[model samples]
Target chain A: MKTKTAPVAVDVARPRPGPLALLAGARRGRRKLGRRVVPYVFSLPFLTLFAAFFFLPFAYAISQSVFKQQRSGLGLGPPTTIFVGLDNYAKALRDPQFWDGIKRVLLFGAVQIPVMMLVALALALLMDSAVIRFRRFFRLAFFIPYAVPGVIAGIMWGFFYSPSFSPIRQLATTTGLPAPDFLGPGLVLWSIANIATWEFTGYNMVIFFSALQAIPQEIYEAGRLDGLNEVGIALRLKLPMILPALVLGLLFSLIGTLQLFNEPLILTRLSGSITSHYTPNIYAYNVAFVDTDYYYGGAIAVILGLVTFAFSFGFLRLTRRQSGV
Target chain B: MRNWRHRASLCLALFLGVASVLSACSGGGASSGGVVQLTFWSFNQQITEQADLFNKSHPNIHVTALKQPSGPNQYYPKVLTAVKAGNAPDVALIEYQYIPTMVSNAALVDVSKYGANGVKDQFVDSAWAQVTQGRAVYGYPQDTGPMGFFYNSATFKKAGITHPPATWDEFAQDAVKIHALGPNYYITAFPPQSTGWFQGLMWQAGATWFSVDTAANAWKVSVNDATSKKVASYWQALVDKGLVSTVADFSNDWNAALNKGTIASWISAVWGQGVITGSAADTKGQWTAAPIPQWTAGAKTSAMWGGSAISVIAGTKHPQEANEFAQWYLTNSGSLSIGVKEIGWFPSNKTAQQSSDVNAPQAFYGNQVVDTVFEQAEIPTTWTWPPNLTAVNQFMGDDVNAAVANKTPIVDALDKLQGQIVQDMKSNGINVAGG
Candidate 1:
């Protein structure tokens, strides 16, 4: 029961140009070639960078993870790199310190990620409201922390946490109140988390705030028509609209928390609790450089990469499934 | 589609072109007029000045010395990576504890062929022993930190201590007396981060943390053996009694404590006087030096903490010239005098140690001849620094510092570290003998 469709009138009444079809064909050929080449030229810079820095390193690390550097006798000669298959992976898995680092970072994320997201969302919502004053100033002030380098921020917080250098500690002791040791074994993790939260909360707020800004005014009108107040409109309309931003923020924070190094590294000078294996990234670093065993470090790095990929992929798929259903 | 192929080909060509241009900018040093150029990398500016002097003296061989980052945490990785990449300097200053690791990696050249053994008689036995392994000489010892005891005379006077503690028992008793002066004061600080200092203490107690078996081609680790555990327990008792503060060495708090008379004394190497002088500005004339307290009543045994040697890197084009520079840097009176003046280097060269410049009273130690204290020290020659010492130190810093912070037995930490060190060496394909 297929019906025959008529040809377009323009195709039926097409006229030949004065230059004829041969010249037109040549011109079209050049145009097609140009169209094919132009995009590649535009993308050459970024594509080169991606291939060199990111893709090449990922490939090299994976390759190195399969090999072990071995030395014989007194180890006073050149080392030989030999194939060990999955032995490196097995070794990393069996390492108690490596697992301890992962467990510690996970514990840190469980407490830090949720608290950070809520604070960001609340701040973004507060800034979005009509009653908010000094909007530009507030945004800049909040974002300034993100602009500060992580090492510098960690050092600043380290000084603040130190019993000797901190004015707050001195003041507390003078006022007859014992200043709780912020770098103590029990509180060191939370202290690091506070530094991380202070650094990234503003960045997440910007993401959520931008998403809030993107929502049309008509959505608010629709909520108003449903007899909803401003708070209800924000809760019912704006909040759900920025779910993608929230998920993105959570994903980035999780990844960052797992790779914690600079903060704990700077704080290590102040606290005895932060070990060489305080975080997985730091442990991998100590293994590679401090311990000079790049094979094991490479294996640890690959394992961490796989775990992060699994988590991120699973999260995205789960969110999509829920939204679709 | 064929045009698409052309596009990809063009893109790849462009990438290669750009990469070549970027890499070209990293061209190495080139010499002119028959001069052989050598690059020298070290953490101290004094080394560079010494190199400059060498360049002036040697007309045919030119050297460009670079001042790298300080501390083991920052400097070691840079040189190690440079060695791997074959971009390493012709010469590098390596610490005695770290040289074994470098030798294991083949980053250092064997200077034995360059007649490094001929001048062995010029160096102290302890310094000479560190740079030589089974007759293969790696480098020349620039300096050695013979351990000593430094105290605040004012603080000692206030604590009613007549003289410096001459034995471990007396040190402990004096620590108690100093702590009794006030709640704010302690005899000294047992820095949590300075595992090298602890290792130095163990060495003084006659603990051979490492011993080599050439017949079996294996390393025997005794980090937590009887001698070491004895030293650890002694320090642990002091920590438990709150007779010593556990502040990090050279930290702002430690400096403040030293300045404010809270921490009264420091048990450190000869170079520690430099650290104290650099940090504690207000306590200039109040400081004095003494020999490290003995475990047995009359033991003169001492140990090293932070000192370095000059090694010719494996990839150097001018090995002979590089070795010559290293030798001169270590043994030359001119270079040694400059080091003594500029960076407070305690010469490992026997003749240089007797030079007027070295024997001259250091104003920082209240114009006292502090070398007498350090020179009298007799460092043991049998103790070997293992190739895995760097990792061992990190483990000590972590486990030992944890124990120190948690108010637990420090000997347990040492035992844990001993196991970890052996395991680390074995995993690295080094021969570790016995469990």
Candidate 2:
């Protein structure tokens, strides 16, 4: 076997020598070069867009975070932008409202993420099962909510959550049940969470469903042969296989929770519970726009971004370690 | 292969070049007929219509009005961005409360140079006070919203109340009597987010929260002074006693309460008359206007709440034309009539207030001359807003809401707000007194 393989390897490795062979070699070299350069050429547009829209703004925000706009005595002149390195960041860190917003979102995500992901996972599993009827219709129905824009969804849910106009409240009253104040101070966060879940569960469900589809059918067959039922197969085989997708979904939810703005902003008119500083993103927006203090706003935004990145990376690392990858 | 690559790059370059040129050509479509074109940003469509009227009358100068979003939430940020970009409109409509902020930021032109001083006597003293800082006049007052009590007459009659309360003592007694009618009923809703309305109350209570001394170049921030604290404590007691509901203003809940006759009155502004008329149309002839209850009996003093002004922005090349249009839009009888009749804005010009359209009886308030009540309510002692008024108002609202919801003392909230306003002002390099 060694003698046969050695001659084959030598023949494959041998260089061509004739003029026609040299011409062919030159052609192959050109083709190889083309193959190496084509992908970068194809990606140039995307790279340009990413740099322009994402990287440039990110760099600008970083620079802006270090400077502050100061006015003269009595603030009766045009504000002068001056360099104040890390001062804005320090002030942001000291702001009670900023911390309160961060804490509120952290609490919001802690509860919202698990509930949203579980519902999405359950729906995905149901659709992936063989016993389900009208699978296509069910999938479409589950995914339809992901198509609705966030602002439109927030407005729609605002009407439903409104105590005066909510059909839910009317139904509750007619049925002799106590009416729930969904927009009250204690329940407003959960109300926001419910809207977010309704908006994004379908999106996460699609991710999970696609991941489930990519699984080899042979593993399920083996599980069936081993006397494992559907639930057992889902828990033991399918779940572990889709762990990476679950982590990806979790990371997306984590980042999204930190950037909460639109729902709370619209809901402010409906509910007194949502203040200008209800969430970190809202606080940053109020600081930058309402207060016209973009320096501190930029600092808060950068800090939030860093926190999101760190949390997601740490989570990914933790999951990889637990999986012994 | 190299030739093909070269041709592909050339094609891409050509495409980008064409696209940029197309985008560039699509902008600046203003008329260039030797007419000086001036852009004006306004929150109301009435101003745009008035500008159209101006355009028809003036052949040499053309004014284009761009309607901005109504509230400060979106409007001020857009103005700031435009000003920063140095591409702001020549003239813009700024609310009276925001005039100090705009002036302090130097976003407005000193229109006194353009005959603004000559027309000072055209506007009400309080309205003029809003636009002028010392000798520098920044804008012409467009409208004012003096505070008033919009009460439900039907509810009052049902509760056996004969007249509107003349004092806080009488008001509190009336609230108790009104609440006695039913468990679901309250005298009024104290909306936590209604900082402007609350400010009007403070104003009526003689609380000078902000006072600027231009000669000294200093600001007196007395947000939690004795008078303001008294106002806070008084409301706190009412809220604590559950005599007033904590419904947010402009909310469906508040409207539902009003429509159902659960709330007896709205302590709002002249502009609120239109809002109530529109939102609670079923309660049309049942509603009536009265002076807001005073701290002392038989007092005629009142305070201003919401209003706006028209100003030339600092960077405008056509300051003369912009000021001319502003003066015309505000002072001209034809323009004033249009604003009063078409737009719901209460005129800031004394002559405009005296116009027949304003003096005419309205069907909304049971044919009462509601404008007369507002006219008297624009008292000279109305509170002046500080340069940092927006931030101060927001902090007050947030803290007040927290106090109301958490059952904490409202005076404590005021104290916290006072500290925050001082810190915020000082951080912005404003010289703050009583810090």
Candidate 3:
């Protein structure tokens, strides 16, 4: 019995030495090396670009926001940059024009986003329905405006908004109706909203339609088996299925509405309604480039960026909780 | 092993792509040669033509003229960015009003260092004053936009008005008589967006809104001074009375009004004659030129509206060559003649002003010697612009436009303009007084 026990104990004490153990060790080593190197290799280009364009500029802008370039006396000599912590931010916060710009954009977004999204969703739903004809043509036609650049689109819409040479005004006059002053101060914001809706609705529609296509056929079959009609299915099943896309679309539109710049910039010369400080971005741009007050502009930009981040993060958090994502 | 090789190749490709992009960005310097290549940026077509002429004449120096967009909104930002990056053109065209801003920013080199002072007597005093900061000359005067009145002669004739109004009171009376003709007709269109023109009117009224104290090195802004208020109220009354239409200048509606005989006249600069002729071509031989109507009777005072100077940017590699080109292009009789005759840029040079090309009658203005009217209208008036004049002007435009839209009183607008200007100047680190 002692001899048998000693042989068993010696067998257990000896380290495992076989082809299977050796192969497992080699596999473990390979996976460890891969775990270390694979992510860097995959992310190198993106990381480089991100660091160069986004991170570096963002860091610089933050640093610049704390400094002020002061011109002494007559401002004839070169300006001297000095550190003025929080002064620029304080000034921006106190500026009426900046607040006015924020209010204008908020008001614009409030009315524009709902109308734009509703129209986009309706078009996307129609295109997705079996009752629709020439779906591809309609999709392509709707998406074409997104292909046109913002500045060019603004210019094209500006022609229709012009009181002097507008074809719409001509039609109104010929029809014995009062020619609407589209570029008048009272109506210009709506005109700008119209341009924004025209430009981005098509883009959002495509996003929604693509999302709608991804809905499983079995789900539709199941809904139909329960006596759900096309509209009923679309309202209950398809809409819920595409809620993530809708949220994403809403976030994009919200960010765009906050950062309004190009349309007002191009419309400045054509209409009196658009001022140099028409929107926050325009105001920051004027302060930075036009006024040559880089510090103040940087502060405004940082504040605006923070506001955007807060809004987006808040929205994402809310949606995540609601959808249990 | 294959995957590693593929990754290596991808990394190499990205490196090459980045290198190529960097190389592309680093391009655009003097080519490796004996030739001195100078880059000139201008919004004026005449400058491009003249640059071509210079290139043909001087083989040692090659100038590449790049055309920028005309408006300050597009062009000024590009210039400012280039100036900041130290990659600005050798020579650039700047409006006279922006000279102080450029000077304060130290964006222009004193051209007097390159013998610019020698041609000081060649340009009009006001034009010369615009290019000089204290004692240092910064640029060569390119063109002058002496203010003048462009009237529709047929409209005046139909209204039984024999002569042009010589004073504001007579102008107002004529506006009433012209408005009585029909609902469509008015004496003139009061352009709400014409801040420069409005400033010209204020200047003619002896209103010096901005002045520099060289000794103390301070800027004085007096935007809502008595003379300016008088000018504002005069126009405000006319606008409120519906005697004048509040149309924007250089707009399609304005041109339509001019062509349709609804707007009888334009109190515009010399450059406006060319614009009117081009835009209202069908009204040829019906237009006439006169001095801008005065605030005081028999007063010969006038003010400049739009003019520009060719300035050498501060860090130009070829400053001497740029100065040479600027001097030659502005003062040379041959080049000035082309600028005046072909391009219709009213010359600032004395010789160019006296040239037969400028003195010749324009058929569009019914054989009127419009250039002579413009030349005679260049009176000695105190016109000063602050370093933050652009900001001040923007505020002024907003207030004035508000007044025009009837959202605010003209006096209130002027008061707000004054406060905003002072506040803006102070915020921009400028010394301000008389707030």
Clashing residue pairs in candidate 3 are none
| TM-scores of all candidate predictions against the true structure | 0.92, 0.90, 0.90
Interface RMSD of 1: 3.2
**True-vs-predicted CA distance for residue B46, candidate 1, Å:** 2.8
TM-score of chain B of each: 0.90, 0.89, 0.90
Query: Model 2 chain B — which ten-residue stretch has the worst lDDT?
Result: B22-31
lDDT of 1 by residue, A10-96 (tens): 333336654555566666678789999988878877888888777887788788889888988777667888999999999999999
lDDT of 2 by residue, A121-167 (tens): 99999889988999989888988988998888889999998877899
Off by over 4 Å in 3: A1-42, A322-325, B1-23, B27-31, B158-162, B177-186, B213-217, B259-261, B378-380
Listed in order, the DockQ scores are 0.45, 0.41, 0.39
Instruction: State which candidate, 1 or 2, has the greater TM-score.
Output: 1
Candidate 3, residues A279-300: lDDT per residue as tens digits?
A: 9999988888877777788899
Candidate 1 Cα deviation (angstroms), residue B64 = 2.8
Q: Candidate 1, residues B221-275: lDDT per residue as tens digits?
A: 8888899999989988999988999888877788899998789999998878777
C-alpha RMSD over true interface residues, each candidate: 3.2, 3.3, 2.9
lDDT of 2 by residue, B1-435 (tens): 688899789768855865686467444424477788899898676777788889898998898888887643678777876776577888898888888888766789998998898988988887798888889888999888788898999999999998998888888999999999987699999988888889888988988888776676788878788999999998988898889888888777888889888898999888788788767888878889999899877787778787889999977777888889888999888788888887777888989887888887878789998888876663655356788766877798788888887788888988899899988888888887645
Error of 1 at B156 (Å): 1.7
Candidate number achieving the greatest TM-score relative to the actual structure: 1
